[model samples]
Target: MDRIEQFAPPAGTAGTTTDVGGVIERMRGFRSHWPPGDGVAVFNEVYLTVTETLGRHLSDGAFRDREAVSTLDVRFAERYLAAVDTAVSGGLPPECWRPLFQYRLHPGVRPLQFALAGINAHIGHDLALAVVDTCRTLGCAPVDLEEEFERVGDLLVMLEEQIREDLMPGPDLLQVADPLTHLAGAWSLERARDASWSAARMLWRLRGAPPLAEEFRSRMDAGAGLVGRFLLTPCR
Candidate 1:
């Protein structure tokens, strides 16, 4: 998945008119196995990025004090996979099509389509905490981690924005931003982990398909901007 979405493949990818054949033949670039379609590629790629990013923090005991948060992160991964399976087995109904975006090239593009949003923000936040810990461990100041922290924050926001239309979380979706206010102070490891898990729950739950595009066709009108924007900020 990462292979496909990271950028244009060596031979480039399926263009705007890509059919299943084009997606399978042209899509390229995973560090591992290459998926067959744009849907699978993009959704899985983004998910991999998010998970690996969070995993880095989890390894540092950022989640050591919060068993529940750790559990939720694990659970969200499992559930998100299931949701994707469900969508693939039976393509989304018209009302639920927003979950897949052709241009994203990363798997798991839907914000509200799956039950994973709650953990998304939380994982990102925990990742932030890990960054804080790493910096401190390396003898860097909190101020030194500020730029890095905002990068993760921007990532969380992008995840939120991508899934926004799919889940339609009302105003509550915006609440995740509030945690940013507290980021100035290096948070307790446990607090950061819990907050991250909480926000992920909210964001991932918005993963249901809403009417948007067709199967094997480009649906993301401005996907380049969405992800380009995310990259401009930086997280992983």
Candidate 2:
């Protein structure tokens, strides 16, 4: 199996609709960050935007605290929610989702069972801190039952709107519902708006120092060893 084979053939985006070549191109084309890297930048942008939107809600007593999650996180959450029905419906993707889940859970792929919003919110400081603390105790990133249950109900509601009511993708995750799940209508126009912002965010993160705080920069740049270990860390 390939590295990404863990996730199933995404439910709606497979076949001629998604164009595996296009998907590959897009994945490879993800040039959202540099000097440091794209992955960090992408996450950082989402982090900052969400934190910024949180405003007075953050502990910092000001708006746009990079460390604290914010309203933009909801936007990112919305994106994940939009893509989730497709992301999870297929048992699991043979690639990204399943492989990662199986690797973490071993003997099984329980992580794949998590809802979309669950996964989206999982990468933030709160979740990251929890895992870090847990890892410190275990002397390794403990691979246990994935934690996303708290977010499932909310995620499902958002997904229902994107699919049933609003009938649209949030704008971060690539939309697989074009001409497939949704053809011509206001959704097409909505897609254009979402895609533009998402693309811009990607570009911004890849180019240089993102909106994230200095500490996050330090953590990301800590070293490849730590990050790689993080990649393989279990989801439970």
Q: RMSD of each candidate?
A: 17.1, 19.0
After superposition, which runs of candidate 2 have C-alpha atoms over 4 Å from their true positions? 1-61, 64-71, 82-84, 91-98, 107-230, 233-236
Model 1 residue 142 lDDT?
41
Best TM-score among the predictions, by candidate number? 1
Residue range 1-236, candidate 1, lDDT tens digits: 44323432343321331122222232223323444444444445555555555555556655432333333334334333333333434434221222232233444233322223223222433343333334434455445444434444455456544544443446553354533222212223234344543433333333243232122112221331232223222111
| Candidate 1 deviant stretches above 4 angstroms | 1-37, 91-98, 101-236
lDDT of 2 by residue, 106-181 (tens): 4211221122212223332123333333334334422320222123223333433443333223455325553322
Q: Native-vs-model 1 lDDT?
A: 0.36
Show the lowest summed lDDT stretch of 10 residues, model 1: 212-221
